[model samples]
Target: MSRITALTPDQVPAESKSTLDAFTKNIGFTPNMMTAFAKSPIAFNAWATLLGSMSKALDVKTRDSIGLAVSEVNGCNYCLTVHSFTAEHMAKLPADEIILARKGHATEPKRDAAVQFAKKVIETRGNVGDADLKAVRDAGYTDANIMEIVALVAMYSLTNFFNNVFDHEKDFPAVTPAGAI
Candidate 1:
């Protein structure tokens, strides 16, 4: 593995120029994980697009559950940090609820179903049996809702797995000591 270097604008390839520029303007900086990923713009673009589409399609409730489940399973420090915050802050999920979801003990009927279904999706590698599908449907998720979960798992899995393999460090400096990721 190459020594993972922090990417500065001077290091970005031409292919990554526009995307990183747009990202810097929005978030105040290009995310370090993405800057590392921009080494291959195709992969970076794929990651960006997949995460965006999945984010737009997912219900906030389902997204938090899925985020907790996949991050736990992947043991991805970077994702666990960001998604936990997003789950708590953006999704407005209670901290206790996210804790429960991480432990597979979420009590809310819909959320428990989402977490369980997401765990099964990762464990089964998309060969998720009918029983799992039936359970999610019974939990009040429509087929479209369930499909959004499939996309969520796949997209997060890509980033989670990448972060692990590439030694991608956390982007946000503010949360490092908590070890939440």
Candidate 2:
């Protein structure tokens, strides 16, 4: 592994410090991923706000399911662990369902659709066809929800690529380590 930088709030630029400060107060600490994001506060804030808004606007389980599917497909352990925590603790998705999604299984109709759609979107890389969207719609998502699904995929993709490139070791539970992907 490349010698990893210990990113901290104090080490961040002032504008990033303020944004990360809000995260620290709300979550007790800023995620290591966010500190990595401190490299460009303008981009970080935009991503953070979009991610936050998506979380708030959707059913938490749906959001987490899509996120998990994307991360798992992308092999992003950092994104996986963070969203897995959210899925289990905040979203309250069943553990079995989370496991199912992780392995590309559809545990139920609704979850299956979300995970399947996310997988297709990620695998196809924006080349998803109308049938994919139709399946997502048939699964009870609206056009707006479909957009959020895309957003989740995009968000996970961005973070995963960044983390993998920098070897952004996971902090929570520290399940992920310095070994390169």
Best-matching candidate per TM-score: 2
User: How many angstroms is residue 108 displaced in model 1 relative to the true structure, after the best TM-score fit?
Assistant: 3.0
TM-score of 1: 0.82
The residue-by-residue lDDT of candidate 2 on 1-181, one tens digit each, is 5225757546788877777878777667677777777878788888778777777656777667777777777877777777777777777877777766666556668768877888898989979889988888998988887787788889878887877677665666533321232
**Each candidate's clash count:** 1, 0
Off by over 4 Å in 2: 2-4, 105-108, 174-181
Please give the distance, in angstroms, between residue 171's alpha carbon in candidate 2 and its true position after superposition: 1.3
Quality of model 2 by C-alpha lDDT: 0.74
* Residue 97 alpha-carbon offset, candidate 1, angstroms: 2.2
Prediction 1 global C-alpha lDDT: 0.75
lDDT of 1 by residue, 108-180 (tens): 7877887898888887788888998999899898888888878888888888788778766566533322124
